[model samples]
Target: MRLTIERGALLKALGHVQNVVERRNTIPILSNVLIEAHDGSVTFAATDLDIEIIDGAEADVERAGAITVPAHLLYEIVRKLPDGAQVRLDLSSDDPRVTVTAGRGRFNLPVLAAGDFPAMSSGTFDTRFSLERSALARLIDRTRFAISTEETRYYLNGVYLHSATGDSGLALRAVATDGHRLALADHPQPEGTTPVSGVIIPRKTVQELRRLLEDAGEEVEIAVSEAKIQFSFGRTTLTSKLIDGTFPDYTRVIPKGNSRVMTVRNDEFSRAVDRVATMAAERSRSIKLTVGDSKVVLAVNSPETGAATEEVEADYKSETIEIGFNAKYLLDISSQIGTGEARFEFADAASPTLVRDGNDPNALFVLMPLRV
Candidate 1:
């Protein structure tokens, strides 16, 4: 393809799609990106068979054509080019080599057969909705830490999204659990859009897309079918096949009847947990909590190692209770609280604990207790 594009624009476009391409591939075409120039615009697409990303950028196309070229090499070359420089690309032969020239630099990169590249199927998705990337970002940020890495329980390996009657009438909820703890966050649904059908989005897609949308506040269109899902943003699109297994029922694990309430500064509690947990041996990074009338004691003891205790005065008048939690889990929830006060609800030492910001019933968190 022959096209002239701004270096910044091309790099930004490639940055979005090239990440979907793997560094190493068993098949030749899988390691390349399909570049198409047409109607004064250029598009780049890459995939690893499971996930695909397509990005389009404005350019000057002298001759409309398509070719497949090494994605990483192109990214590096375009990245190193002078800022604001314009780039011109043209095909050198039917063998698919591409001649790239910009300012005072010129190089021909070996290419693969564009015909060999796997095409992304545009399947009909049943559920369609548009959500603010910011809201989705909050949901993802709040729950991603709890995602399970254990491969055997594939069902719990991603975030569970579904329709729920939350504090707000109809809500979009995201939940992640690794058996030790669970992170749940809820937000109001947009007008005319029903709640998202209960589905488990794989961890890889969740994480990759989360990083992409961090600074993005635009509205994102989402389409979900029986076995696949698609995300459409400004000039980029992501399509992935959903995980095949079922996600375990998460509602049952949430402790609803916890009556004893504890309110603490999010930063303070997280700091105490982090400091005390350090003294815990690697095997058991456990932090024990002793709740009293007006004080809370954070303590950790490793038999082979030393012990640590921190007294953080709390506004608690409930019955005295001792509970144990994985320090990592507590730290995760507290960090996400971000500039807000957090509350903990407990029924007993053996029951799960419900945590959230003060009076913000919509955003909730649950942590299962650890026996110390």
Candidate 2:
């Protein structure tokens, strides 16, 4: 196999696919990337059994063939090469190694048979849809923070994506929770999308997909089946397996009868919580909020550290209420509120509190109170 590709183009393709390859692999071929050079283009593919990524770039092909090489090693070599230099990869039929040449630098890397690289087979998709990049990004950004990392309750380790009936009509929703907090976001369902059963996209897949979307075009094509999901972005494609466990009914945890409401500027509230949290205990990181009239006071007390208090103006007319919460959880939810006002509904200090973004009615958050 022989091909010449621009340094920048080759680096971009390698950077996208190499991340899916794990640093340590029990199987030899799993640690390498499969490179296929044909016609006028070259494709790079890498996988770790559960998730696979493929990226392609145009190249000047002298002899068309396929080979596999160390993914990270090849990526670093191309990344450090001169910016505009042309890179040539050559592998003769009798040679067992591939030679990389750029300018005066030459390096030989061992090769593995391309046929040994496992390809993730995507079975027939039951649902297919298209979503604008911005819309899909919004759904992910607002809810991913709450995805649980606990392995025992594997169902909560990913974002639950499905179709639901919203205030306006049919909506595509993303929900994630870690028991202490939950985040839910919605977007209008695309016109021709078929209804699909809810799917739990694993955490790693969600993260890799988010990174790919950063450079994606205006629209992304999505295909979903019972056991797998695929996202196609022009020359790149990502296929991942769906988690098998069933996610709990999240609606039961979202409080519905909270009567007390307090509205405060998100930025101001976030800053106040951050300041008082410095004195909180390392394990709990608990902060208490005293709300009444048109103001709220945040306080943190730790036996080993110290105590701190800060007051912020708010819009509230209900009876006085005191609630305790984890300072980090509060900040995570506040950041998602953007620069708008944060509305909090309380039903005393023992029940869960509902939070919403004033500027975006499609997003919601629920936080469980701690015993202060």
Candidate 3:
């Protein structure tokens, strides 16, 4: 393959696809990227068997052909080249190496047959939909922090995405939990969206997709089946295998009759918790919340680190209640509350507590209290 492309354009495409290639691989071809030049553009594809990413850039094609080369090495070489430099790639049928030329620098990289690269087959999609980029970003940011990292509960290691009925009617929801904390966020269902069964999008796939969305256009196309899911950005596409397991019914854990309510300034509450948590034990990181008539006291006591306390003004009229919660979990949920005020509903010190944004009714969080 012989083609010429701008250094910035080539580097951007490489940056997108090379991340999917594992640093170490048992199969030689799995460590390489498949590069193809044809139809006035060049495409770079890389995969780690479970996930595949393909990105393309416009280029000057001298001759149409394809080849495979070390993904990271090529990326580094092109990245170090001068900005706006023209990069030329040349490969001959009989040669076992591909020559890369930029400015006065030239390098030869070992090549592999393009046919040896594996491709993740995209089966027929049972449901296809389109979502505004901002909408999808909101759903991921609000819930992904709660995704479980425990390996045994494989099903909980991803966000549960499905259709459900919300206060506004039909909605698309994303829910994630790690047993200690749960986060749920919803967006109004898009027009012409086909109802789909709940699917577990693995953590790694969610992270990669999030990175791609940062530079994606206004709209994104999504296709889903029982086995795989695909996201198509303008000049880039990502295909990933869905986790093969059933997520537990999350509704069972959400409390239904918590009537006690406390409304506090989110910024004030977060800062207070952070200050008191400095004295919390390393293992438990537990902080106690003493809610009273119109104020809340945040305290942390550790045998090794001593004790710390802070009082934050709040709007609460219920019976005084003292609850214990992980300081990190509290801060994480608090960050997702978009409004200035954060509302918390509690049943008792021993029961799960419900938290919500004062302004955004579409998002909610549940925190399991710890024994302080």
Candidate 4:
């Protein structure tokens, strides 16, 4: 098999697919990328048995054939080649190696039989739909910070993606939590989407999908079955196995009747929290908020470390309330509010606090208070 591909194009395709190959492998074939040449294009594929990515790019195919090569090695060689140089790849038995040649450089790499690679099942999807890339990105960015990293509660490791009838109407919602804080966001459900059982997208899949959607303006085609989910965009396709656990009922975690309300500038609140947290204990990271009389003061005190206090102007008209919260949690929730303003609704000092963007009702956050 022989082919010539522009270095830039080859590097881009490899970058998209090679990340799935783990640096350490128990199986030899799993460490290599399956490269197939046919028609006028070359396809690169890599997988970790759980998730797979395939990317195709246009190339000059002299002899159509396939081979497997170390994904990371090929990527590095192509990436280091001169900018617009054309990369020539030849698989010949005389040398018993795959030859990669560019401007003034040439390297020989060992190859594996493509037949040894495991095949990813193209399972029948019970539901398929199309969504705007920007919309999907919004849903993920808003809630991913709250996804639990704890492995024991496998159910909480991914975002809960499903269809729901929100106050605004039918919507596609994403929710994630780690028992300390919860994030919930909704987008308009795409047309002709049939309701299916909720699927918990593992955290790793969310991150990769997010990267794929970056700077993408085209609509993304999605297919979901009971066991797997697939995303197709441009010349790339990603398939991932769904977490085989049930997501807990998240609606119960969101407070329904938190009456006390406080409105503050998002940036101001974040800055105040950051300053007060400087003196907070490294382990606890707790900061106290004193709310009253159209103003709120943030304070943190540690026995061995010292204390910090900062005041910020706010529009708090409800009964004075004091609450304790983890500084990092406050910053995470505040950073998500796109609008310059943020609203906090509280039931009391001991209950969960609801945080929302003053301009966007479709997204909100619920954070449990810390004992201070």
RMSD for each of the candidates: 1.6, 0.9, 1.1, 1.1
- Each model's lDDT: 0.86, 0.95, 0.94, 0.91
**Candidate 2 per-residue lDDT over residues 268-346, each given as its tens digit:** 9999999999999999999999998999999988889989999999999999999999999999999999788999999
Which segments of candidate 2 are over 4 A away from where they belong?
none
Q: Estimate each model's TM-score.
A: 0.95, 0.98, 0.98, 0.98
Instruction: Write model 3 residue lDDT over 8-88, tens digit each, in one string.
Output: 999999999998888999999999999999979999999998999999999999999999999999999999999999999
- For residues 1-372, write the lDDT of model 1, one tens digit per residue: 688999999998888888878888888898899998899899899888888888899999999988899999999999999999999998955635789999889989998777888997978988899889988888898888999999999988888888788876888888999998888888887779856778888898897789678535489898888788888887788898787888888889888788888888878778888888999878767789999887789998888788999988677878999999888888888888866688889899998999987745677788888898
lDDT of 1 at 42: 91
Query: Could you tell which candidate, 1 or 2, scores higher by lDDT?
Result: 2
The Cα error of candidate 3 at residue 31, in Å, is 1.3
* Residues 265-326 of candidate 4: C-alpha lDDT, one tens digit per residue: 99989988988899999998999999998999999989979988999999988888889999
Q: Which sections of candidate 4 miss by over 4 Å?
A: none
List the candidates ranked by lDDT, beginning with the highest. Answer: 2, 3, 4, 1
Q: What is the lDDT of residue 248 in candidate 2?
A: 97
lDDT at position 210, candidate 4: 92
Answer with 1 or 3, whichever has the higher lDDT.
3
Give the TM-score comparing model 3 with the true structure, all chains together: 0.98
